[model samples]
Target: MFPGSETRAGRLLVRARRQGVLLSRAFGGPEPGEALFARAPKPWMRLLPHFLALAASASLLPTTVVVLLGDYGLPGVLAGLLGVGQAAPLLLAGARPLSAWYVVFSTDVLTALALLLWGGPLDGAAWPWPAPTIVGYLLLCLPLSLHLARRTLVAVWLSTAAAAVLVGLLRPGHSPGSSVLLVVLSGVVLLLGGALRERSEAQRRLAEQETISEAERSHRRLLEERARIARELHDVVAHHMSVISVQADSAPYRVQGVPEAARAEFTSIADTARQSLAEMRRLLGVLRSEGTEAEGGGAGPELAPQPGLGELGTLVESAVRAGVAARLTVTGEPAGLPRAVTLNAYRIVQEALANVVRHAPGAEAAVTVALSADGSALRVEVVNGPPATPARPLEWHGTGHGLIGMRERTRLLGGTLDTGPTAEGGFRVAAVLPRNEPAPGENA
Candidate 1:
């Protein structure tokens, strides 16, 4: 076993220890390289590795020339020319790394042949050394295409062994067997480096995949929690509100024949509470379910007999009973409106009137439901005179989540509502909706 590495199971193992000092003196440190070309941009960075490889390849030239010129009696200048020929193609090889494999192989073989031709194997001038050039080859080539492919690794080992044996035989007294062993050792080092690089890349990919999977799981949990909260609020709050409206509506009848005057006031109170509760329940349902049920077939109570254009008068009468001085005015012939449109129209009118009783108490209101010339759309407005007295203190109670609820409902039905002070000292609410339903399976 060599000192810097260990031999195990016939394969050499170089410990993954930092060789910082060794690398620094040979190629200069990375910091110095970066500082030297700091002002240069992308093209320079791309070419830097090739430049370093060229420097490394050329470093071997001086030793080669010295051996040839001093012992083989070749002219020093001629040796320099041979050195340049061997190193120049190596520089090009580094520039286009993947395409340079055969070029590098040829360069090494030629340099070995030049040594043998200048001086026979027995000559001291044939040094049999291309270690520096080979080191440069590994650095530039590894990142480009080194892999753990068994066949490629074996091929590289056999080729290096053959080349080393040839070079040793050309130089007499050098054992071809030892040269084969050394070449095999170098091949083992390349294989080790390639294995570690592959493992490092695989670990990086696995970590990224885990991170993405965790994020997706967290998102799914948050969505599930939101859905659970919606279901809870709708089932508890809306259900109770519905019960309250039903109980309030039945109160007057339950307390009948017990003082007419007192009974009348109680009936009015019960009716007002029922209407308020009904509107509140509708709002809770809308908020909790996000109007999804509207698309699924108008959820909650079944539509035994839904209000349509023909029942506009009945709606106006109900508003009058609810203590709002209201009137209905129809302009065009109201005939054959679709179910969804008719339902939406009734809801708009209902919500508008409800606002008058709750906000503009004891005020006069007007309800107008109309059609366009071509009978394409319906317009419904419920405008009310401002409160006869100061604004009701009871109006601002609760969460003040009603007006917003009404606006949401109107928008969901693809309708618009405008509410504000009128020029003639009144408050106005106007809504224009369609007269035809969306297609048979369509939603609001």
Candidate 2:
């Protein structure tokens, strides 16, 4: 023999040993991962298993006793004991099918052996599997088919067929048709039960996939809203930078009798401002290109000016016209603040009132604007009471991103926002923004 052939044969032997161990484990009692019969969803369907078990027990117990006593002439005590053993297992088959099957099968084999050994003259009686035993076995197989793994099911069916064949060999004179009938009917029940289990599993997986898809779409919308805010801020800063560059370049010409040294200083300021502007435009170009791609290639940034605190009165008026008793109040002297702060503040109020119109129909709303005592921060609050009447159903539902947009705006300005329900069953939204831009690295 070649040297390599010995090594190959040894590897094959190890593989075969592993497979044999797995097969043996499959034929044993139920493992930890095996599926079991689940409770039915509907309230009425849940009682079906109990009803079937009761009906089967009532009918099979008496029939088995009659057959054994009249046909086989067995003693009353032995016949009653065997009848109870075969019929009792059906009650527990839904929860522990494999253990129940073991009990039922053992009783069947013992009864057949008892009839073969001590019985009346068997002149045309069914020897091995009588009608009651076959019915009980088939009933147990219903739950087994729904719960057992494929490997375990195959092992069980094969073992049952093998046992039937051996018993038929022992009694050649009795009818052989009972064994054939039991095997064929049990096979059909298993096939139908397996198909139903597969269909239920497929529906469960489809529902899970739909939930995951909805979450992904919501996350994508949040990212797009943030990008839109960034683009608008970029335009505001660019406009201010352009004015500074033009003023510096023409400074010397505006003032008469200027020194050369000071003129050279103005030129240097203009050069630095122009360089910064160029870099900012390049970055803005990349943002716009990406936005265009996302929007199918035809979208552009809005050219109209962004709104500020001056526009709050118009927003409140529109809400008032739409059935809400809305009021706007100013508590402190208005101070000149950064454009970004004012823009975000206006948007926060706008969204708050819109929510009132949509959710709290016919409710009273109050909008308050105040400046801090030290004049370093601005506070804006909007509160609305509970609805006075039932809200009418509208065909269009919102995208559910209003709160997310408000939170994002506050974070960008390094400010804090608080929102919650009020004591009188109303909602309140409050925000505090710095009057000036935050110091470098302060937010970090």
User: Which model scores highest in TM-score?
Assistant: 2
Taking all chains together, each candidate's TM-score versus the true structure is: 0.40, 0.64
lDDT of 2 by residue, 297-396 (tens): 4443355567777887898889778877778877664456677787888888888877776656645434333323137777778877665555652313
- Candidate 2 overall Cα lDDT vs. reference? 0.70
lDDT of 1: 0.51
Lowest summed lDDT window (length 10), candidate 1: 1-10
In angstroms, how far off is 71's CA in candidate 2? 8.8
TM-score of 1: 0.40
Q: How many residue pairs clash per model?
A: 3, 0
Per-residue lDDT of 427 in model 1: 55
Off by over 4 Å in 1: 1-51, 61-63, 66-68, 71-82, 89-95, 124-151, 166-174, 240-444
Clashing pairs in 1: 121-170, 121-171, 121-172
